[model samples]
Target: MADTEHSSKNVTEVSTDQQSNQSSKVEFSEEEEMLITMVYNLVGERWSLIAGRIPGRTAEEIEKYWNSRHSTSE
Candidate 1:
């Protein structure tokens, strides 16, 4: 009975950890994509200012996404 209870507690903790990781993933809406593209075209990779225009997105995420997409090409 103690082992079973400990197993259940570990499962709960693991589930919470998974949820926390999932929450950290940044999802972009269509409007956000449009805004990112428009701003990218105009300002040319100013991630901080671009992120400022986007709600719920940090400049680091913006930079990471852009780099993931464009770094190979450049």
Candidate 2:
């Protein structure tokens, strides 16, 4: 009975770990996709001008943010 309980607990723990990993993977993939779209939309065009038009954004900061976002994505 003790061994059975231990086995069951181990299985539960493994299942939980797998579920957590899967959730994190899905979130990361989604973020990566969104960032890719954002970068594509903002690259080498009027992004700096747009950012400048925004109330409190600098073009350098926007570029840096996009670069950092893209780096993390890879």
Runs in model 2 deviating more than 4 A are 27-74
User: Model 1, 1-74: lDDT tens per residue?
Assistant: 99999999999999999997775576777888789889999998899999999978988888766776578752
lDDT of each candidate versus the true structure: 0.84, 0.58
* Residue lDDT tens for model 2, 1-74: 99999999999999999997664432224554465456557665455664644445555555555565567642
**Poorest stretch of ten by lDDT in candidate 1:** 65-74
Return the TM-score for each candidate structure.
0.57, 0.39
Which one is best on TM-score?
A: 1
lDDT for residue 9 in candidate 1, whole number 0-100: 100
After superposition on all CA atoms, what RMSD does each candidate show versus the true structure? 4.3, 10.6
Let me know the TM-score candidate 1 reaches against the reference structure. Answer: 0.57
